[model samples]
Target: MDIPAALGGVSTALTIVKQLNDIDRRVDEAGFKLRIAEATSALAEAKLGLVDAQEDIRSKEAEISSLRSLLKRKEETVERSGYRYRCDANKNPIGTALCPVCMDEGRFVLTIQSDQSGRPYVCPKCKANFGYLSAFQDP
Candidate 1:
């Protein structure tokens, strides 16, 4: 479930713990006279259960915090990397002068295709030969 739902569950657990503590005190004061030993034991057990529930809520909250941190980091990385755009011949950018491949703009098509990969690749759609950009060094 989402973070908000998990937080709500944690809140519910806290409320239950508070109620259990109140019950324990009431039972000790009133039920003690009727069944002193049994009431004491039951109250002790309920307190232990409440402690376990509290631990569960803490762990769930920690996990949500960790996930939020990871997402924030990924978003930062995408923002830093400028997109690569493709250009065509005549020094014009491809697809509205936008590099459809890397989504970068303001780049003219490299005069010659790169072949740094040492292998010829054909475009699957146009059957045209293209080289790897790594092979072409910036002039």
Candidate 2:
């Protein structure tokens, strides 16, 4: 009877040890899962930041393109504004000062056409009397 009781006690102790080992393993697995979750959250935040940075870059690029276009138009206007000139009797170019009224209105049209048979030259758009030539360089 004593031997049988000792064997029974040993079996119970072994069962308890097995239960403790299983509990320890479960705790270790839970800790690992928590670390994975934290890492995943960090990755998601980084991706969001990258997307914002890309959008900023795109907006700046578009603004730069618009400014470049405006600059080109301004340069063309400056080049055309030089040397006051007007049209001739046959709608041709000759050396004459451009009408101030037309130039002030952001236009380069010249008053060269003789509307009243040999009267004072008149501008087409503003009808100003003076040399108002067409804005185009060609005739």
Q: Pick the candidate with the highest lDDT.
A: 2
Q: How close is every model to the real structure, measured as TM-score? A: 0.34, 0.38
lDDT for each residue of candidate 1 in 1-139, tens digit (9 for 90 to 100): 2344444545555555555565666546664343445445555555666667678778989978976775553333221123222333343323211122322221223223224444653333333454432222222
Off by over 4 Å in 1: 1-34, 79-139
Model 2 spans > 4 angstroms off: 1-27, 79-139
Taking all chains together, the TM-score of candidate 2 against the true structure is 0.38
lDDT of 2 by residue, 21-78 (tens): 5555565877555545554554555555556667777888997897777555334432
- Top candidate, metric TM-score: 2
lDDT of each: 0.42, 0.54
In candidate 2, which residue pairs clash? Answer: 109-133, 110-132, 110-133, 111-131, 111-132, 111-133
Evaluated against the true structure, the overall lDDT of model 1 is 0.42
When summed lDDT is taken over every stretch of 10 residues in candidate 2, the lowest stretch is: 72-81
Total clashing residue pairs per candidate?
A: 7, 6
